[model samples]
Target: MNETIARLMNHRSVRKYTSRPVERERLETIISAAQMASSSSNVQAYTAIAVTDPQLKDKLAGLAGDQPYIRECPVFLVWCADLSRLKAAAERHASDKPSYEGAAENFVVATVDAALASQNAAVAAESLGLGIVYIGGVRNDIAAVSEALNLPDYVYPVFGMCVGYPDPEHGAGIRPRLPLETVLHMNGYSAEQSGRGVQTYDETTVRYISDRTGGRRTAPWSKLMADKLTAPSRLHMKSFLESKGFNKE
Candidate 1:
């Protein structure tokens, strides 16, 4: 496998982090690397807020479904899909009054760019002997998060990242992923083959969980997935986007 692939394959979410702080310079390097990731159409419609204050971290943790790890991590970064800059640019260009159609499209592009960039930063942090976790729960209280960060219209928080040194006693090893065949398809699609692979991967995941926790209560991967999809996860996302001034047509 390629070197980058090797790094990616070794990736796992780290929840427990040591109290040691990541230095300012190293944090800057990681942020710089994130900025280098490819943006959609070079619009670079993304912004990141590096958070270090303990009080703010605690408040953010509350907004993120009370995830203590959000407060414990040494460095927290909130990635935002920001279309405000482009809107300003258009105004400066004396272009015809802007519309939310492009803003909506640009929001998606910015989200994709921000996610890619943040993952790159996560990889870099891990490579430097740091533990990192992506906090998707930031969306749990989208309005509060936006208000807390003082985000303006046309800017939405995509996700947050927590980075720190790994906790030796509590942190675990790499968790198993679904089998490759389940995810990788040839030129054309084959449902039967993929289904078989999913079944096998479900068993693999069950066994991995059983071993890791030394418990027999592990649910099969299929059931776990069903539980997720069976309920409405992003039901309010459309309205939330609209509230953020993104009119998705």
Candidate 2:
């Protein structure tokens, strides 16, 4: 594989980090790389807030499922799917209020934009020898998180990320992914191919987890997935989105 592909394949979610602070210049460069990510229709409907204050991080860590890494890391970035800018632009250029305030498509586009930008930032940080972990637990209490961040209407904190130099003592190995055959479809699509591929992948994942966790967790991939899906999760997201002036229709 080429150098970029190799680097991308080596990604791991780093939970532990050294006390070393990421340099301001390097952080700016990483943010610039994120800004270079492609946006749907060039709307670029996203915002990233870099928080370094220890007190703020501590509060955020508490809000985000008590993830200590947020407080420990030198930088915690909150990625938000933002439509407030669009609303202002619409008011200035076209109308008194934004027309796409409650459009589901706009919400999707903003979320996609934020995700793409965050991935770009992650890749760039890794390339610079920094470790990063995405913190989706921020969504556990979306309203509280928004309030803490002072987010206005039409802006949702989709997730947060912790970035810093990895602590060698706490380094984790790369986790396995589902087989490409299961995900990549040829021509149109084939359920038989997907099913067979997933069956094999289930076995592969069992072995991987066993090896990774020293056999502490022996459940098959399918079973684990079934258990996870059986649990009610993020049930408040729909109403939360509506409250944020999204998907009102």
Candidate 3:
């Protein structure tokens, strides 16, 4: 495989980090690379808030389910899906004030745009010998996080990312994904293709978990997923988003 492809394939989520800080210049480069990611209709509805302040990081860590990596990492980036700027811009330039920036379609566009940019940042950080992990727990207390970040209307955090040098002693193994056949489909999507490899994938995951936990945990992928689905996860997200002026209509 090519170098870039190889690097992509080798990606692993790093939860523990060394004390080394990411230089401002390098962080700027990563942000620039993130800016190069594709946006729907060039609206570019996203903003990344890099938190280097220890006090702020600690507060955010608590808001984000007390994930220690957030405070431990050199940089904690809160990637926000933002359309507030668009609304302001429209208010300034457009003759008509009848705009729908808060539409459901627009929400999807902003969220996807933010995610695209965040992934680009992740890849760029990885290229610079830094490790990164996405933190969805930021949404656990979405309102609190928004207050902490001072997010305005038409904007909300998509997720947080912890970026730094990975701790060698605490490095995690690369978790295996589902078999290619489970997802790859051609000629107008076939359910057969999707289901064909799940059993095999479950077996692979069972083995992987067994090895990772020293035979202490051997739950298959399907079982884990089922449990996750049954659990009440982030139930406040919908109401929280609505309170923050999202998905109106």
Candidate 4:
């Protein structure tokens, strides 16, 4: 495989980061690459806020489930699914009010746009010898995070990313994934084919978790997922999204 493909294959989340700051020029380059990611109809309805201030990062770390890496990383990026810009654009170009600014379909578009751009940024950062981790805990207290970030209506923080040089002493390794056949379908999907390798995958993950935890935790993938499904998740998402002027439709 080519270097790019190989790099993609070796992707892993890095939680422990060095104190070395990510230079602004390099961060800009990464964002520029992120902007090049494919967008739905070229809407590019997203914004990335790079958090550098130590106190701000600390507060964000607490908001994001107290993730230490968020504060430790040189740059913490908050990727927002932002339709506020689109709404402004519409008002500027044609009407005073946007007809479908809060449409559920547009929410999906913005969220996906943010995700795609963030992944592109991740790849770009990795290419530049930086390590990164995505923080989904930003959604744990979505309202607080939005308030902290000063997000506007029609904008929401989809996720956060911690970026910096990896701490070699505590570097993470690539984890195993489901076999290619399990995910790669010929054309139409086949549930049986997709599920055929899960048992083996569960075993593989059981071992991986054991190794990672020094044998203290050995829960299989299915069991862990089952527990997660049984737990109360972010049940406030519906109301929170509505409050932020998304998914009114």
Candidate 5:
């Protein structure tokens, strides 16, 4: 494999970071790479807010399930799915009133745009030898996070990312993924094949977790996922999305 492909294959989420700060130039380059990511319909409905202020990071950390890495990392970025700019552009140039306010497809487009852009940024950061972790916990309290960032209507903080030099002592090994056969189906879908693949993968995941945790844990991946799914989660997101004028139709 080429260097780029190899780097992509060796990806891992870094939680602990060293005291070293990421340079401004490097951060700019990473963001530039992010902007190069493909957007749905070329709308590019996303925005990234770089947070370097310690106090703001602290507040964000509190909002994001008290993840200390949010405060520890040299740089934190909140990626937002933004449609407010499009609204303004339409108001300025187009004759139509821009019917994005209540459209579900528009929300999906913005969210996908934000996700693609953030992933591009992550890959760029990793290529530069920087460690990073996506902070999805920001969604635990989306309203609070939005308020903290002063997000206006038609904008939503999709997630945050912490970027810095990895602490060697706290480095994480790559966790295994499902076999390609499980995900890559030929022509038509097969439930039997999927079931067989998952069953085999459950065994693999159990062994992997046991080894990774030094035998401290030994539960099948299916069980863990089942437990997670059983728990209540993010019911407020529906109302919150409506309040943000998404999916109103």
Candidate 6:
């Protein structure tokens, strides 16, 4: 396989990092790469906060359910789904835009823009031999995160990224993915054949987890995923989006 494909196939989330810092020149390059990601309607409705403040990182780490890595990472970036810029532009042009309540569609567009940009940054970082991890737990306390970041209306923190050199001793290996046959469908869908592979998948995940974590995780992938989804994860997200000035037409 080619180098790009190799890098993609070997993708793994690195949570632990070495103390080596990413210099400003490299940081600007990564941010430039992130900004180059395609945006919806050319709105480019996203912004990234390059956080290096120790106090702010500690506060953000707390808001992210006390995930120590947030503060420990050499560089932390908070990506935002932002409509505030558009709102400001409209106001600056003296246009009379009405009040907006975020719709599902608008939320989707913002999320897509932010996620694409983040992935681009991640790929760029990895190519530079920098280890990185996406911190989705940034949304665990959306209100607190907003307060901590001093986000204006119409902007919401979508997620965070931790970037640094990998701590060789504690770094993890690539995670297994669902078989291509299980995910890739032809002209039509096939649930029966799709369902058949899940049991084998459970066994695959069980073994992977055992080897990777040293026999610490016994539950299969399905069970672990179910536990996370069955609960009220992101239950407040809808209202939170509505609070921002978006989606209302």
Query: Evaluated with TM-score, which candidate comes out highest?
Result: 3
Going through the candidates in order, what is the number of backbone clashes in each?
A: 0, 0, 0, 0, 0, 2
Candidate 3: deviation at residue 48, Å? 0.3
Each model's TM-score?
Answer: 0.93, 0.97, 0.98, 0.97, 0.96, 0.92
Superposed model 1: Cα runs more than 4 Å off? 1-3, 97-103
Candidate 1 per-residue C-alpha lDDT over 1-249 given as tens digits, one digit per residue, 9 for 90 to 100: 998899888887888898899999889888888888898788888898999999999999999989998999988999998888988888878577755534556667878988888977888888788888889998988888999999998899999998999888886778777778878888988898889988998888888888877986688889999999998885777788888778655
Model 3 Cα RMSD, 1 decimal: 1.0
> What TM value does model 6 have?
0.92
The stretch of ten residues in a row with the least summed lDDT in candidate 1 is 98-107
Instruction: Looking at model 6, report the run of 10 residues with the lowest lDDT sum.
Output: 98-107
lDDT of 3 by residue, 170-189 (tens): 98889999888678777678
Q: For model 5, how does the per-residue alpha-carbon lDDT over 1-249 read when each residue is reduced to its tens digit?
A: 999899989999999999999999999999999999999889999999999999999999998999999999999999999988888887788856555545899899999999999999999999898989999988999999999899999999999999999999998988888777889999999888888888888999999999998999999888988999999988889999889988876
Residues 1-249 of candidate 4 have per-residue lDDT tens digits of 999999999999999987788999999999999999999999999999999999999998998899889989999999999999988888888795547989999999999999999999999999999999999999999999999999999999999999999888997778999978888999799899877777788899999999999999998887888999999999998999999899899
Q: What is the C-alpha RMSD of each candidate to the true structure, in Å?
A: 1.7, 1.2, 1.0, 1.2, 1.2, 1.9
In the predicted model 5, the residue pairs found to clash are none
Q: Candidate 2 versus the native: TM-score?
A: 0.97
Off by over 4 Å in 6: 97-101, 247-249
lDDT per residue for candidate 6 within 1-249, as digits (tens), equals 999999988888888888889988888999899989999888888999989988999999988988888898989999999877776777777577653425556667887899999999999999998988899889998988998889988889999999988888886877788777778889888997677667778889999999878998878888998998888787888777677765555
Where model 5 places Cα greater than 4 Å from the true spot, the runs are 95-98
**Model 3: runs farther than 4 Å from truth?**
none
Better model by TM-score: candidate 3 vs candidate 4: 3
- Please estimate how well model 1 matches the true structure, expressed as its whole-model Cα lDDT: 0.85
